[model samples]
Target: MLENIREKSQGVTAKVILGLVILTFAFAGIGSYTNSVDTSVAQVNDMKITQSDFDKAYQNQRNRMAQQFGEMFDTLSADANYMANFRSSVLENLINEKLIDFATAELAIRVSDERIKQTIREMPEFQVDGKFDNNRYLALINQAGFYQTSDFRDYLRVEMTRRQLNQALIASEFSLPYEEAQLTGLQNQKRDIRFAQISAEQFKASVEVTEQDINDYYQNNQNRFQNQEKVKVNYIALSVDDIADKVEVTAADLEQYYQQNIAKYQQNEQKRFSHILIEIGDDEAAAKAQITDILTKANSGEDFAVLAEEFSADTFSGENGGDLEWIEPGVMDDAFDEAAFALSSVGSISDVVQTDFGFHIIKLTELKPEQIKDFAEVKDEIQQLVSTQKAEDKFFELQQEMARLSFEFPDSLEDAAGAVGGKVQTSDWLTRFGNTAPFDNAKVLDAAFSDIVVKERLNSDIIEVNDSLALVLRTNEYQAANTKPLAEVSEQIKTMLIAEKATEKAQNIAQELLTAFKAGEDVTAQLAAVNASFEVKNDIARFGAELDNNIAKEAFKLPHPVEGTLSASTVTMNNGDLALLEVSAVKEGEPATNSNFAQQHSQQLAQATYKSFIDALRDQAKITRREVVQSSEQF
Candidate 1:
C-alpha cells in the first residue's frame, strides 16, 4: 500500500500538483526536469502515462530520497545511476496504476465524501501528541506540494478507484488447483547443508593498520569535508495556534455567528426508510407487471418484509426485511430519494416510484425533527476558533521581536532572548553535516554551516525548523579539522571486541547444533536449554501471503521435508534476529470438491477480469516515450 501511494504521488504532474489536488506536487521548483514529450513512457489500455507524469513521479522520488538520506547519500551514486533506476521503477509502477484506473473507470467504482473525510481525520501524521492537529495537517499538505483540499481529494479518489478495481480484479482472476499447485509445490522442496562461520575478530590479527594509513584514508575523502551551505533565516510568522489563547470572543459574537451560519447548528431531518424493490428486465411490460404486483401487496398492508420476499427482486435487502437505514437527501435514486423525502410522517408509504432500478415502494419508518443548537451547546467549538486566532497573534509577535533583535545585534544570541523573552539555548561546537549537540533539526544544522556563522561569526536568523517553534543561533567558536587519535578510541576498540566475540559465540553454537542434528541428536533439547522456541511454519502456500523477504521464496525452492536437517542457513532479520530452519513437513495445493471449486473459480474469475481491465488501460494510455535513464538521481 505504501509503494502504491509512492507510485501515484510520483506520477503527479506540475499542473496536477498545482492543479488543485492538495498534498501532491508543489508549485515551486523542488525537483523539476526538462525532457521531450513523446507521449510513450507507458500505455494503459487506451490511456497514457504522459512524460509530465513520469517526470513528476521521478522528481518527487528524488526529493524524498534526498530528505531521507541527506549527506550520507552523496557518496552512494552519481546522477546517471539514480536516473536509470528511477525510470525503470517508475515506469513499471505507473503502468500498473494507469491500468487499474482504466478498469476502475469502466467499473464505475466510487468513494463517498464521508469516507475521504474519515481517512483524513484518521491520518496519524495530521495528529499532534494524540489528537488531530489541523495546523499540522495543513502544513503537511503544503510541504507535499499541494495547494488545497480539493486536489488532495481528487488524488484520494484515484487511489480509491485503483484499490476497488484491484479488489474486483482479484475476485475475478480465479486460479485453479493446478495453478495454485504450481506455486505451492515449490514450498515442498528441501535441501541439506552443514556450515560454519568466521568472525571479524578472527581477521583482526590479520588486519593491517598504521598511523600513515589512517591519515591517507582521511585525506582521500575530502568530499566528506566539502561542506554544504546551510543557513538560518530570520523571519516573522503568523499562525492561528499562537494567538488563540489571547483572543476573547464574547457570547454575543458567538450567538451572532451562529445565527449567521444557522445551518451548521440546525438538525437536518433524517428518514428511516424501507423499500420493496421490483427489479426490471429490459422488457418494459415485465417490469410493469412486477411493479404492479408489489404495489398491490403493499397497498393491502401486507407485512413489508413478507411482501418483499414474495414479490421483490432485491434479494439482499429483501432478506433483511426490506429495512434501509436512516438516509438523507441525495442518497438513493433520484425518483426514490424524492418520494422518500417527501414523506411528512412515520408509517406513510409512497406510491410506486419508478427509477433506473425499476420500481420502489418506500415506507417512512421514522422522522427526525430539525432543531437549532443553542450557543451554550457549542461553546467548545467557538472557544477553539477564538483561542486559535489568539495563539497565532501571540506567536507571530514573539517571532517578529526575535527577528528584529537578531538583525540589530547580529553577533549576540542574547539580544533576541531579551526582545522575545524566549530562552537562548547555546551549545558547544556542532559538525557541518552531522547533527549533534544543540542541532537536531534540518534547519538548525543548515544554519551551523552558513557564511555568517562560519566566516563572519554572527547569529542566525529566526529559523522555523518545523511548524510549532522557531529558533536563532550564534556560533560561539569554530573547530578546525581534526581526527581523534587511536589512543582515545582504544576503549571503543574493546567494545567492538565484545560485540564480535558475542556474534562468533552464537554462530559457533549454531554450527555445533547443525553437526549434532546430522548425527541424529535431539535438537529441541539444545534450543530448550537456550530458552528459544523452534518455530515450524507448516504447509505454507507460496503466493497470496505477505512475506517480503527472500525466505518465503527460498522456502518454496526447498524440496519436501525429509528426516534430515536441511541446508545450514542464515538470515539476519531487520531487527538483528537470525534463524536456521529444518524442513519437517510439506504439502501442496490440490483441487477441492465441486461446490468449493465453483466458489473459488467465481472469485478468481472476477479478480482476473478486473486486473485485465486495468492492464488494458495502462497498455493504451497516452504515455510519453524516453530512454529510461537508470540512476538514483531520478530517485
Candidate 2:
C-alpha cells in the first residue's frame, strides 16, 4: 500500500514528505540514524551536535552578513572580537534549538505529514501564476543546493515541528482583563498643553564675537584644518572586457562547445494535468473514501474538469476547472509525479493517487516532448559563450605576467604593460578619501599610499579589483599632511562662535522663565514683557502630529498634572529654539473594548509567556559546551 502510494505521488511532494519524516524522527531522539558521532562540537543530553553542522550554519550566517553589509562586511568579519561574538551567538542558538527539539519529543509534540504537504504547496517561491508548478518547485530546490528533494523537506519539517510546539506553549498563556485594560489606557492617554517659544534669532542680533575669539579657537584646534595625504599613481589594468575583442572564437570552437554542453540545450518533457484533491486532515479515512468515489466517477466517463470544478478541495486550482497547466517531472509530490508521467498518452485518466496532500484523481490533458536545439539555432549564443571564456582565460594569463613583470622591474609600470600588451594608465592627485574610479577601491588606495609604494618607489603587488580584473600601481607623486594657516579659517571660526553665543543666550532666557514659572510667577506675563507671543495648543494625544513633535514628545514624558494644578517643563526644538511648556490638564484614556485590541493584546501576552517558557527550559537543561573551537578560514 505504501509503495503504491509512493508510485502515485508527485515527485516534489513525495521527497518533501520523505525529508520531513526523516527530520521529524531525527529530532524526536531516534539516535540510530546519526550522520557523524566522532567530531561533536557540543552535546545536549545524549545527542551530539556535529562539527559539520556548526560549520555549515556559521558559513550560512557569514554569507548573509556579507550580503547585508556590502563592503563593510569584510571589515567586521575580519575583527576578532566580532567573529568571536558571532560564533558564540550561533552556538547558543543551536543549543536552544536542540533544547526545544528535546522538549517537543518529551511532550510528544508531532506535526502531521499532511501539514508539511500543504505548506510546500502554498509556498510562494514554488508557485507560478498563483498556482504550484511542479517544475518550478523542483528547479528552485535544486538551485538552492538541495540535490535530493528529501533534504529540503527535512529542513521544512524541523521548522514546522518547532513552530507547532511553540504555538502549543503560547496557547497555554492567559492574560487578565484588568491587566489588558490598564495597558490599553496607558497606550491611548492624552494631554492638554500650552507652550511659548524662546527663539534663538531673538538674541542673535545682541550676540558679538571678537577677533581674539577666532584666533584663540584656530590656535587651539589646528589639527581640524589640515590637508589629507594624497598620491598619484602609474598603473597597468587587465580586465576581461578589454581582452574580449582581441580574443577570437572560430566556427569549430562553437560547434565543439555546443557538443560538450549538450544538456544545457535540451528542454525537459512536460505534461498538463487536471486533478480533484480530497485533502486529508484528522479524518483521513473519510477523505480517502470521498477521493475513491470521485476516481470511480472519473473512470466511468464523467467529465473530469466538471467533477474537479465541483469537488476539488485545492482552491487555487479548483476554480480554474482543475487546470494545473504544464508540469515537469519531480516538480510535485512523488506519487502524483509518477502516476501522471506513467499515463500512456494525452487524455488518459490516472489511478487515484495518494500523497501527503491527500488523495487526487488525475487526468493527463496535454504532453510536451523534450527538444534540443541544433548548432545552427544556437550558434550566436555558443559563440558569445566561447568568446567570454577565451577572454577570461587571456585576462588571467596577462594578470599573472603583469604581476611578475611589475615585481621584476619595481621602478615603472612600462615594463609590465609592454610585457602584457596593455597600456600604462595615470591618475590625477587623489586624497585618502578620494571617490574617483580605481582610487575608490579601498585595497588599491591603501596599497598606493603605503610606504613601500610611495617612499621606496616600488611597484605595488597586483590587486584584484574583482573577478576577471586586476591592477598593479606605482606612486608617481605624493603629498604629505600639513595644517592650514589660522588666517585662512579665522572668519569661519568667528561665525561659529557667534552662533554658540546666541544659542547659550536663548537657553539661559528659557531657563529663567522655567524657574520663575515654578516659583508661582506668571510666565505669560513675563513673555509679554519681552514682546514675545506664546503659542497655545490643546487636546494633544500622546501621538498627536499637529503640535511641534519635539514638544509633544517632551510633554508626554512629563508627570501628569496634579488636580487643579499644571505641570511645567522646557524642551529644545531642532531649530535651536526652546519652548516652555505648561500642561494644564491630563486626561486618562478609556480602556479599549474593540476586537482588534483584544486580539493584539492576547498575541503580546502569549509571546511573553512563550519566551518565559523557553527561558525556563534553558535554565533547567544540562547544557555542556565543548572546548572553544577557533573558526576555520574555510568558512
Candidate 3:
C-alpha cells in the first residue's frame, strides 16, 4: 500500500528530513538537482531509474526502519546484501511511479492548485480544536523542513495526479455474477469440526535428548554454524546533550536577555491574516527583480489583492484576489510577521519586508490586543541557552582528552578504558548469524567473529552501527542452528493440521449453503437446524458508500436481494479466509449530514476508484523486474 503517512520509524529525524526533500523534488525544487543520473536501477516507461534516486529512497527506508524499531533495530545497513534488496524495491517503486505519470499525461488529467488547496484545508493535521488553524499548519510544515506551503501543496498535486490516473484505469472494471457467486460461497461457508490439539508441552514428559543427537543435528546444519561477515568501528557522537551540560546562566545575563525580548513571551489577542504567495526560484534572479517591481506598486497604495492577481505566482489564492483564509502570529516569515503586526490598524499596508520567497508588502488585515505570557514564563528557555554554551565548551575539552587517550592506546580496550576512567563491560555470547540477545546488530555480530576477535581473542575494533554510537565486541563462544528431532516436532505438526482441517471443513459448509440457496431452499433455516448460526445484516455498501466488509458490500450491490440469489462477491476475513458472497439485499448508503463526513466519504470513494483503475492496468500490462540477489539474506 502507498501509505499516506510516514509510519513511525527508528531514526525519525533523518526520515522526516528526507521525506521533506522528496516532497521538495515533487514540487520542482532543488531536489531534482540531486537526482541520480545512473541508468541501471529502475525503468520508468522509457526512462531508467538512476543510482542516486535509488540511494535516496533506500536511505529514507533505512532511516524509517531504524526509527520504527528504535534501539532494537535489527536490519543491517547498506551492506552488499541489503543494498541489492534496496535496489530492487527502489526500481519497482520508480517504475510504478513512472508508469502512473505517463498514463496521467496521456489521459490529459491535471491536478489543479485549487484541488491541492482544498485538500490541505481538509487535512486533520492542521486542525486545532477541530478547526483548521493557519498558524498551526505553517508551524508544522516549518518543523517538517518545508520552506513554504507552496512546496507542500505541490507534493499533494502529484499524489492527486497518481490517484486520478488509477481511477481512470478502473472505471469500467466490475465484478460479474460468476465472480460474485464464487466469492459468496466462500464467505457463507460453515465449519463444524471436532479435533484434538496436542501441543509440544503435552508430550514434554515423553521426549528425551542425547548428546549424540545434538551433535548429529549440528553437524547436518553446518552452514548455519558459519558466521556472517561483520566489522567493528570506532567513532564519537556529537549531540545536544553533550554541549548543554556545561553552559551556566548568570542572573544578570537572564535579566538582560529577558528585557530585550519581553514582548516575545507576552501572550496577545493575535490577529489572523494570510497572504497570496509569489515564489521566486533560486536561479530566477531576473524573475525576483521583476517581483520587486510589483511589490513597489503595492507599496504605492495599489490594492495588495489586485497586485497579487496581476503578478502572484500563487494561482490558487490569486483567483480569489489573493485571499489567504485566516492566520495568526508565527504563521509567516520573521520579517513578514514583524512588518504585518507593526501596522497600527487593519487595512494598513507596511513597507516591503524581504524574505527568501521574494519581497513582501504586508497588509494588517486585522489586529488583537496583548495578554500576559511574560518573560518569566520563558525564563527557563533563556537559562538553557546559557547552560548550552557552557556545556559546548566543556564537551569540546573532554573530546580532546578522549581523542588523545584513544590514539595512545589504539586497539587496546583495557588501556583505553583505564585512560578514560570509563567502565569496560563484556557482552553475552553472540553468534555472527544469530538474533539472540546483545547481538542483533549484524555488523557488530560479524565483528565478534572476525579474525581479530576470534584468532587473537581480543576486543574487535570499535564498530559504529549508526551515526550516534560505536562499540567493540569480543566473541565468547558460538552456537550452531539445529533442527529438533521428529519426536519433538510431532506435536507441533498435529496442532497445525487440526486448524487446517477446521478451515477446510468451514469452506465446504459455506459452499453447500450457497448451493442450497440457489436451489430454492431456505439456507438460513438449514444452518439453524444444524446448530450453525448465520447473520443477515442489511444495508452494507462499498467503503465510503457505507461501512461494511466485502461480503456486505456485495450484498448491497445486488439487484434482487429480497428474492433471487445474490451475485457472488469476494471477501477476505481478518483470519486469512477468502469467501464468496451472495447479496441478500440492496441498500444505498445514507446521505451524509456533516461536511467532514461527506469529504471523508468522497476521498474514500475516490481512492477506491483509483485502486480499481490501477488493478485493471496491471492486468493488461506486461512488466518484468530483474531479480538481483546480491546475497542470501532476505528482508
Highest-lDDT candidate: 2
- lDDT string for model 2 (483-555, tens) is 8877788877877888888888878888899898888886777787555556767778877668778998988
Expressed as tens digits, the lDDT of each residue in 1-635 for candidate 1 is 32243346546574476566443335534344333435556655466666668778876765677689985444332333654565687787777776566656767788987577557767898766765555566669888777786788788878877777566557545556665455434434332321222233433454445556545544564444344334332323333454454467777766676677778777677668788887667787787777777777777887877787677777765786777756656446678878988888887888888897777888888787877888888878866765665466567777888787776666566767766645565464455444442354546666666766667666666777555566677666665555555555544554554555555565666667667766777777776554444554554556535442445555555566555445434443333334444545555444333555556656767856865665666456655445653222222
For model 2, state the Cα shift of residue 517 in Å.
Answer: 1.7
lDDT of 1: 0.61
Residue-by-residue lDDT tens digits, candidate 3, 431-531? 44435433555566566666656665555555554433345445445443355555564444444444555555555555676676567776556555444
Sort all candidates by lDDT, best to worst. 2, 1, 3
Best by TM-score: 2
Clashes of each: 86, 21, 36
- The TM-score, computed over Cα atoms with residue i paired to residue i, of candidate 3 is 0.49
